[model samples]
Target chain A: MSAFKKIIPLFDRVLIQRVKAAERTASGIYIPEKAQETLNEGLVVAVGPGAFVDGKLQPVALKNGERVLLPPYGGSAVKVGSEEYLLFRDSEILAKLE
Target chain B: MSAFKKIIPLFDRVLIQRVKAAERTASGIYIPEKAQETLNEGLVVAVGPGAFVDGKLQPVALKNGERVLLPPYGGSAVKVGSEEYLLFRDSEILAKLE
Candidate 1:
Protein backbone atom coordinates (compact mmCIF):
# COMPACT_ATOMS: atom_id res chain seq x y z
CA MET A 1 0.00 0.00 0.00
CA SER A 2 2.83 2.36 0.84
CA ALA A 3 4.46 1.80 -2.53
CA PHE A 4 1.20 2.43 -4.30
CA LYS A 5 0.66 5.58 -2.30
CA LYS A 6 3.80 7.03 -3.81
CA ILE A 7 2.19 6.97 -7.27
CA ILE A 8 -0.27 9.76 -7.99
CA PRO A 9 -1.77 9.42 -11.40
CA LEU A 10 -2.46 12.78 -13.07
CA PHE A 11 -5.60 13.80 -14.92
CA ASP A 12 -7.97 10.88 -15.15
CA ARG A 13 -5.14 8.34 -15.07
CA VAL A 14 -5.44 5.17 -13.03
CA LEU A 15 -2.86 2.85 -11.52
CA ILE A 16 -3.75 -0.80 -11.69
CA GLN A 17 -2.17 -4.05 -10.54
CA ARG A 18 -3.00 -7.00 -12.76
CA VAL A 19 -4.83 -9.84 -11.11
CA LYS A 20 -2.89 -13.05 -11.48
CA ALA A 21 -4.43 -16.02 -13.21
CA ALA A 22 -5.11 -19.24 -11.36
CA GLU A 23 -2.16 -21.65 -11.28
CA ARG A 24 -4.24 -24.82 -10.73
CA THR A 25 -7.46 -26.40 -11.89
CA ALA A 26 -10.53 -26.99 -9.79
CA SER A 27 -9.45 -30.55 -9.15
CA GLY A 28 -6.03 -29.32 -8.06
CA ILE A 29 -4.18 -30.15 -11.27
CA TYR A 30 -1.13 -27.93 -11.66
CA ILE A 31 -0.97 -25.75 -14.73
CA PRO A 32 2.44 -25.18 -16.20
CA GLU A 33 3.76 -21.65 -16.53
CA LYS A 34 3.85 -21.90 -20.30
CA ALA A 35 0.17 -22.89 -20.37
CA GLN A 36 -1.00 -20.06 -18.15
CA GLU A 37 -3.40 -17.59 -19.72
CA THR A 38 -2.62 -13.93 -19.34
CA LEU A 39 -5.61 -12.15 -17.88
CA ASN A 40 -6.75 -8.57 -18.69
CA GLU A 41 -8.27 -8.08 -15.28
CA GLY A 42 -6.80 -5.78 -12.67
CA LEU A 43 -7.42 -4.02 -9.36
CA VAL A 44 -7.44 -0.25 -9.18
CA VAL A 45 -4.70 0.96 -6.92
CA ALA A 46 -4.92 4.70 -7.48
CA VAL A 47 -6.94 7.21 -9.48
CA GLY A 48 -6.15 10.74 -10.62
CA PRO A 49 -8.25 13.81 -10.29
CA GLY A 50 -10.61 13.96 -13.23
CA ALA A 51 -9.59 15.89 -16.33
CA PHE A 52 -10.66 19.49 -16.75
CA VAL A 53 -13.36 20.36 -19.20
CA ASP A 54 -14.93 23.75 -19.86
CA GLY A 55 -12.80 25.18 -17.03
CA LYS A 56 -14.16 22.71 -14.49
CA LEU A 57 -12.50 19.59 -13.18
CA GLN A 58 -14.65 16.54 -13.56
CA PRO A 59 -14.16 13.61 -11.20
CA VAL A 60 -13.42 10.15 -12.45
CA ALA A 61 -15.95 7.43 -11.73
CA LEU A 62 -13.40 4.83 -10.63
CA LYS A 63 -12.41 4.27 -7.02
CA ASN A 64 -9.54 2.47 -5.34
CA GLY A 65 -9.87 -1.33 -4.85
CA GLU A 66 -12.35 -1.66 -7.69
CA ARG A 67 -11.86 -4.55 -10.11
CA VAL A 68 -11.61 -3.42 -13.71
CA LEU A 69 -11.39 -4.93 -17.15
CA LEU A 70 -8.39 -3.62 -19.06
CA PRO A 71 -8.09 -3.09 -22.76
CA PRO A 72 -6.07 -5.65 -24.74
CA TYR A 73 -3.15 -3.21 -24.71
CA GLY A 74 -2.09 0.46 -24.33
CA GLY A 75 -1.35 1.32 -20.71
CA SER A 76 2.08 2.56 -19.67
CA ALA A 77 3.84 -0.02 -17.53
CA VAL A 78 5.70 1.04 -14.40
CA LYS A 79 7.96 -1.10 -12.26
CA VAL A 80 8.01 -0.36 -8.55
CA GLY A 81 10.56 -2.57 -6.87
CA SER A 82 9.70 -6.07 -8.13
CA GLU A 83 6.02 -5.37 -8.77
CA GLU A 84 4.65 -4.09 -12.05
CA TYR A 85 1.83 -1.58 -12.36
CA LEU A 86 -0.03 0.01 -15.24
CA LEU A 87 -1.20 3.56 -15.83
CA PHE A 88 -4.26 4.16 -18.00
CA ARG A 89 -6.65 6.97 -18.61
CA ASP A 90 -10.11 6.35 -17.20
CA SER A 91 -11.49 6.40 -20.74
CA GLU A 92 -9.04 3.72 -21.92
CA ILE A 93 -10.36 1.25 -19.39
CA LEU A 94 -12.82 -1.02 -21.15
CA ALA A 95 -15.20 -1.62 -18.29
CA LYS A 96 -15.63 -1.93 -14.54
CA LEU A 97 -16.07 -5.49 -13.41
CA GLU A 98 -18.86 -6.36 -11.02
CA MET B 1 -15.69 16.93 -44.74
CA SER B 2 -18.91 15.05 -45.43
CA ALA B 3 -17.11 11.75 -45.14
CA PHE B 4 -15.57 12.75 -41.84
CA LYS B 5 -18.91 14.06 -40.63
CA LYS B 6 -20.24 10.52 -40.79
CA ILE B 7 -18.15 9.61 -37.76
CA ILE B 8 -19.49 10.64 -34.38
CA PRO B 9 -17.24 9.58 -31.56
CA LEU B 10 -18.94 8.76 -28.26
CA PHE B 11 -18.11 9.58 -24.68
CA ASP B 12 -15.10 11.85 -24.78
CA ARG B 13 -13.76 10.14 -27.87
CA VAL B 14 -12.18 12.00 -30.77
CA LEU B 15 -11.80 11.20 -34.44
CA ILE B 16 -8.56 12.23 -36.08
CA GLN B 17 -6.86 11.90 -39.42
CA ARG B 18 -3.08 11.56 -39.17
CA VAL B 19 -0.98 14.21 -40.84
CA LYS B 20 1.23 12.76 -43.54
CA ALA B 21 4.98 13.16 -43.53
CA ALA B 22 6.74 15.03 -46.28
CA GLU B 23 7.48 12.89 -49.29
CA ARG B 24 10.38 15.00 -50.60
CA THR B 25 13.55 16.47 -49.14
CA ALA B 26 14.42 20.18 -49.08
CA SER B 27 16.79 19.55 -51.98
CA GLY B 28 13.89 18.07 -54.03
CA ILE B 29 15.03 14.50 -53.46
CA TYR B 30 12.21 11.96 -53.54
CA ILE B 31 12.21 9.96 -50.29
CA PRO B 32 11.39 6.31 -50.85
CA GLU B 33 8.42 4.76 -49.08
CA LYS B 34 10.69 2.79 -46.76
CA ALA B 35 12.51 5.91 -45.68
CA GLN B 36 9.35 7.87 -44.89
CA GLU B 37 8.79 8.42 -41.20
CA THR B 38 5.23 8.09 -39.88
CA LEU B 39 4.15 11.26 -38.18
CA ASN B 40 2.48 11.42 -34.78
CA GLU B 41 0.48 14.51 -35.64
CA GLY B 42 -3.16 14.67 -36.65
CA LEU B 43 -6.12 16.90 -37.36
CA VAL B 44 -9.12 16.63 -35.07
CA VAL B 45 -12.13 15.68 -37.13
CA ALA B 46 -14.72 15.20 -34.46
CA VAL B 47 -15.12 15.05 -30.72
CA GLY B 48 -17.67 13.47 -28.44
CA PRO B 49 -20.01 15.43 -26.18
CA GLY B 50 -17.68 14.56 -23.32
CA ALA B 51 -18.07 12.01 -20.54
CA PHE B 52 -20.60 12.45 -17.81
CA VAL B 53 -19.34 13.15 -14.30
CA ASP B 54 -21.28 13.70 -11.11
CA GLY B 55 -24.54 13.97 -13.01
CA LYS B 56 -23.22 16.70 -15.28
CA LEU B 57 -21.93 16.55 -18.83
CA GLN B 58 -18.46 17.96 -19.40
CA PRO B 59 -17.15 19.27 -22.69
CA VAL B 60 -13.81 18.24 -24.12
CA ALA B 61 -11.23 20.98 -24.50
CA LEU B 62 -10.31 20.15 -28.07
CA LYS B 63 -12.01 21.58 -31.11
CA ASN B 64 -12.41 20.35 -34.65
CA GLY B 65 -9.62 21.30 -37.09
CA GLU B 66 -7.08 21.66 -34.32
CA ARG B 67 -3.69 20.12 -35.03
CA VAL B 68 -2.70 17.83 -32.20
CA LEU B 69 0.10 15.53 -31.21
CA LEU B 70 -1.00 11.93 -30.96
CA PRO B 71 0.46 9.17 -28.86
CA PRO B 72 2.70 6.85 -30.78
CA TYR B 73 0.26 4.00 -30.17
CA GLY B 74 -3.25 3.28 -28.96
CA GLY B 75 -6.28 4.22 -31.04
CA SER B 76 -9.00 2.34 -32.89
CA ALA B 77 -8.43 2.55 -36.59
CA VAL B 78 -11.36 3.08 -38.92
CA LYS B 79 -11.35 2.99 -42.70
CA VAL B 80 -13.74 5.17 -44.60
CA GLY B 81 -13.44 4.02 -48.18
CA SER B 82 -9.70 4.41 -48.89
CA GLU B 83 -9.06 7.00 -46.16
CA GLU B 84 -7.88 5.90 -42.72
CA TYR B 85 -8.98 7.50 -39.48
CA LEU B 86 -8.30 6.94 -35.79
CA LEU B 87 -10.53 7.14 -32.76
CA PHE B 88 -9.03 8.01 -29.39
CA ARG B 89 -10.17 9.40 -26.11
CA ASP B 90 -9.51 13.09 -25.56
CA SER B 91 -7.09 12.28 -22.79
CA GLU B 92 -5.12 9.97 -25.07
CA ILE B 93 -4.21 12.98 -27.21
CA LEU B 94 -0.86 14.22 -25.95
CA ALA B 95 -0.94 17.91 -26.86
CA LYS B 96 -2.21 20.58 -29.21
CA LEU B 97 0.27 21.89 -31.75
CA GLU B 98 0.33 25.66 -32.07
Candidate 2:
Protein backbone atom coordinates (compact mmCIF):
# COMPACT_ATOMS: atom_id res chain seq x y z
CA MET A 1 0.00 0.00 0.00
CA SER A 2 2.85 2.37 0.84
CA ALA A 3 4.44 1.72 -2.53
CA PHE A 4 1.24 2.60 -4.39
CA LYS A 5 0.87 5.74 -2.29
CA LYS A 6 4.09 7.02 -3.78
CA ILE A 7 2.32 7.39 -7.12
CA ILE A 8 0.19 10.44 -7.76
CA PRO A 9 -1.75 10.38 -11.00
CA LEU A 10 -2.02 13.67 -12.91
CA PHE A 11 -5.02 15.31 -14.53
CA ASP A 12 -8.03 13.03 -14.23
CA ARG A 13 -5.91 9.90 -14.28
CA VAL A 14 -6.93 6.98 -12.03
CA LEU A 15 -4.66 4.27 -10.69
CA ILE A 16 -6.18 0.78 -10.48
CA GLN A 17 -5.20 -2.72 -9.56
CA ARG A 18 -6.59 -5.48 -11.80
CA VAL A 19 -8.52 -8.19 -10.04
CA LYS A 20 -6.94 -11.62 -10.54
CA ALA A 21 -8.82 -14.42 -12.24
CA ALA A 22 -10.09 -17.44 -10.37
CA GLU A 23 -7.60 -20.32 -10.32
CA ARG A 24 -10.26 -22.92 -9.69
CA THR A 25 -13.97 -23.41 -10.31
CA ALA A 26 -16.66 -23.95 -7.71
CA SER A 27 -16.35 -27.71 -8.21
CA GLY A 28 -12.63 -27.50 -7.50
CA ILE A 29 -11.59 -27.94 -11.11
CA TYR A 30 -8.23 -26.29 -11.68
CA ILE A 31 -8.04 -23.92 -14.60
CA PRO A 32 -4.92 -23.73 -16.70
CA GLU A 33 -3.19 -20.40 -17.19
CA LYS A 34 -4.17 -20.23 -20.85
CA ALA A 35 -7.71 -21.32 -20.05
CA GLN A 36 -8.29 -18.70 -17.41
CA GLU A 37 -10.58 -15.87 -18.43
CA THR A 38 -9.05 -12.48 -17.87
CA LEU A 39 -11.49 -10.14 -16.21
CA ASN A 40 -11.50 -6.40 -16.87
CA GLU A 41 -12.50 -5.57 -13.28
CA GLY A 42 -10.27 -3.42 -11.12
CA LEU A 43 -10.11 -1.63 -7.80
CA VAL A 44 -9.41 2.08 -7.83
CA VAL A 45 -6.34 2.85 -5.81
CA ALA A 46 -5.77 6.53 -6.53
CA VAL A 47 -7.26 9.33 -8.56
CA GLY A 48 -5.89 12.57 -9.95
CA PRO A 49 -7.32 16.00 -9.56
CA GLY A 50 -9.92 16.74 -12.22
CA ALA A 51 -8.80 18.35 -15.46
CA PHE A 52 -9.26 22.03 -16.16
CA VAL A 53 -12.47 22.99 -17.92
CA ASP A 54 -13.47 26.47 -18.94
CA GLY A 55 -10.29 27.73 -17.22
CA LYS A 56 -11.28 26.09 -13.96
CA LEU A 57 -10.15 22.82 -12.40
CA GLN A 58 -12.88 20.21 -12.11
CA PRO A 59 -13.10 17.46 -9.53
CA VAL A 60 -12.88 13.78 -10.49
CA ALA A 61 -15.97 11.65 -9.94
CA LEU A 62 -14.19 8.45 -8.93
CA LYS A 63 -12.74 7.79 -5.51
CA ASN A 64 -10.28 5.41 -3.87
CA GLY A 65 -11.49 1.85 -3.06
CA GLU A 66 -14.17 1.94 -5.73
CA ARG A 67 -14.57 -1.07 -8.03
CA VAL A 68 -14.62 -0.23 -11.70
CA LEU A 69 -15.01 -1.84 -15.09
CA LEU A 70 -12.11 -1.40 -17.51
CA PRO A 71 -12.06 -1.35 -21.23
CA PRO A 72 -10.76 -4.38 -23.07
CA TYR A 73 -7.54 -2.52 -23.88
CA GLY A 74 -5.75 0.75 -23.23
CA GLY A 75 -4.38 2.33 -20.03
CA SER A 76 -0.71 2.70 -19.05
CA ALA A 77 0.82 -0.15 -17.09
CA VAL A 78 2.83 0.73 -14.03
CA LYS A 79 5.03 -1.60 -12.03
CA VAL A 80 5.60 -1.26 -8.30
CA GLY A 81 8.07 -3.93 -7.26
CA SER A 82 6.36 -7.21 -8.19
CA GLU A 83 2.90 -5.64 -8.19
CA GLU A 84 1.42 -4.20 -11.37
CA TYR A 85 -1.07 -1.36 -11.73
CA LEU A 86 -2.80 0.59 -14.47
CA LEU A 87 -3.28 4.30 -15.12
CA PHE A 88 -6.26 5.54 -17.08
CA ARG A 89 -8.20 8.73 -17.43
CA ASP A 90 -11.42 8.88 -15.42
CA SER A 91 -13.35 9.10 -18.69
CA GLU A 92 -11.67 5.97 -20.02
CA ILE A 93 -13.23 3.88 -17.30
CA LEU A 94 -16.31 2.09 -18.61
CA ALA A 95 -18.49 1.95 -15.48
CA LYS A 96 -18.67 1.53 -11.72
CA LEU A 97 -19.51 -1.90 -10.35
CA GLU A 98 -22.18 -1.98 -7.70
CA MET B 1 -15.96 15.61 -44.51
CA SER B 2 -19.62 14.67 -44.63
CA ALA B 3 -18.73 11.10 -43.76
CA PHE B 4 -16.95 12.16 -40.56
CA LYS B 5 -19.96 14.18 -39.51
CA LYS B 6 -21.86 10.99 -38.96
CA ILE B 7 -19.74 10.15 -35.96
CA ILE B 8 -20.83 11.64 -32.64
CA PRO B 9 -18.36 10.89 -29.91
CA LEU B 10 -19.86 10.20 -26.47
CA PHE B 11 -18.72 11.80 -23.25
CA ASP B 12 -15.36 13.69 -23.62
CA ARG B 13 -14.39 11.39 -26.49
CA VAL B 14 -12.65 12.95 -29.47
CA LEU B 15 -12.50 11.85 -33.08
CA ILE B 16 -9.16 12.39 -34.79
CA GLN B 17 -7.35 11.57 -38.00
CA ARG B 18 -3.69 10.70 -37.60
CA VAL B 19 -1.33 12.88 -39.55
CA LYS B 20 0.32 10.91 -42.30
CA ALA B 21 4.06 10.36 -42.13
CA ALA B 22 6.34 11.91 -44.70
CA GLU B 23 7.39 9.50 -47.39
CA ARG B 24 10.25 11.63 -48.66
CA THR B 25 12.73 13.94 -47.03
CA ALA B 26 13.48 17.51 -48.11
CA SER B 27 16.52 16.08 -49.91
CA GLY B 28 14.16 13.93 -51.99
CA ILE B 29 15.36 10.71 -50.42
CA TYR B 30 12.58 8.18 -50.59
CA ILE B 31 11.99 6.37 -47.32
CA PRO B 32 10.71 2.82 -47.44
CA GLU B 33 7.60 1.90 -45.51
CA LYS B 34 9.71 -0.07 -43.02
CA ALA B 35 11.90 2.96 -42.42
CA GLN B 36 9.04 5.44 -42.13
CA GLU B 37 8.51 6.77 -38.67
CA THR B 38 4.88 6.97 -37.54
CA LEU B 39 4.03 10.35 -36.06
CA ASN B 40 1.83 10.93 -33.02
CA GLU B 41 0.17 14.03 -34.38
CA GLY B 42 -3.48 14.25 -35.39
CA LEU B 43 -6.17 16.60 -36.60
CA VAL B 44 -9.23 16.99 -34.42
CA VAL B 45 -12.33 15.95 -36.34
CA ALA B 46 -15.10 15.73 -33.75
CA VAL B 47 -15.57 15.86 -30.02
CA GLY B 48 -18.18 14.53 -27.61
CA PRO B 49 -20.22 16.53 -25.17
CA GLY B 50 -18.30 16.97 -21.95
CA ALA B 51 -18.66 14.28 -19.31
CA PHE B 52 -20.91 14.89 -16.35
CA VAL B 53 -19.24 16.24 -13.22
CA ASP B 54 -20.90 17.34 -10.02
CA GLY B 55 -24.25 16.55 -11.66
CA LYS B 56 -23.48 18.97 -14.50
CA LEU B 57 -21.92 18.47 -17.94
CA GLN B 58 -18.66 20.26 -18.60
CA PRO B 59 -17.50 21.20 -22.07
CA VAL B 60 -14.46 19.71 -23.77
CA ALA B 61 -11.49 22.00 -24.22
CA LEU B 62 -10.45 20.91 -27.73
CA LYS B 63 -12.17 22.10 -30.85
CA ASN B 64 -12.43 20.92 -34.43
CA GLY B 65 -9.42 21.52 -36.73
CA GLU B 66 -7.01 21.76 -33.83
CA ARG B 67 -3.68 19.94 -34.14
CA VAL B 68 -2.95 17.68 -31.17
CA LEU B 69 -0.38 15.27 -29.82
CA LEU B 70 -1.53 11.69 -29.30
CA PRO B 71 -0.26 9.06 -26.95
CA PRO B 72 1.90 6.27 -28.40
CA TYR B 73 -0.86 3.78 -27.61
CA GLY B 74 -4.57 3.68 -26.68
CA GLY B 75 -7.61 5.12 -28.46
CA SER B 76 -10.36 3.15 -30.22
CA ALA B 77 -9.89 2.90 -33.98
CA VAL B 78 -12.91 3.57 -36.15
CA LYS B 79 -13.18 2.73 -39.83
CA VAL B 80 -15.45 4.67 -42.09
CA GLY B 81 -15.27 3.38 -45.66
CA SER B 82 -11.56 3.48 -46.59
CA GLU B 83 -10.63 6.06 -44.02
CA GLU B 84 -9.50 5.31 -40.44
CA TYR B 85 -10.03 7.48 -37.40
CA LEU B 86 -9.32 7.21 -33.69
CA LEU B 87 -11.61 7.86 -30.71
CA PHE B 88 -10.03 9.03 -27.49
CA ARG B 89 -11.02 10.96 -24.43
CA ASP B 90 -10.02 14.63 -24.46
CA SER B 91 -7.83 13.99 -21.46
CA GLU B 92 -5.98 11.30 -23.40
CA ILE B 93 -4.68 13.96 -25.74
CA LEU B 94 -1.21 14.95 -24.55
CA ALA B 95 -0.73 18.46 -25.92
CA LYS B 96 -2.27 20.83 -28.42
CA LEU B 97 0.22 21.77 -31.13
CA GLU B 98 0.34 25.46 -31.88
Among these predictions, the greatest lDDT belongs to 2
Candidate 1 at residue B30, lDDT? 94
Residue B43's C-alpha lDDT in candidate 2?
A: 88
Q: Is the docking of candidate 1 incorrect, acceptable, medium or high quality?
A: incorrect
lDDT of 1 at B6: 83
Per-residue lDDT, model 1, residue A71, is 97
Worst 10-residue lDDT window for candidate 2 chain B reads B89-98
lDDT string for model 2 (A13-83, tens) is 88899999999998999999899999999999888777876657878879999999999998877654578
- Best candidate (score: DockQ): 2
Per-residue lDDT for B1-26 in model 2, tens only?
34544898999999999988778876
lDDT of each: 0.81, 0.82
Can you write out model 1's per-residue Cα lDDT over B5-31, one digit (the tens) per residue?
A: 488899989999998876887798999
Model 1 Cα lDDT, one tens digit per residue, A38-86: 9999999888777776657779779999999999988877655478788
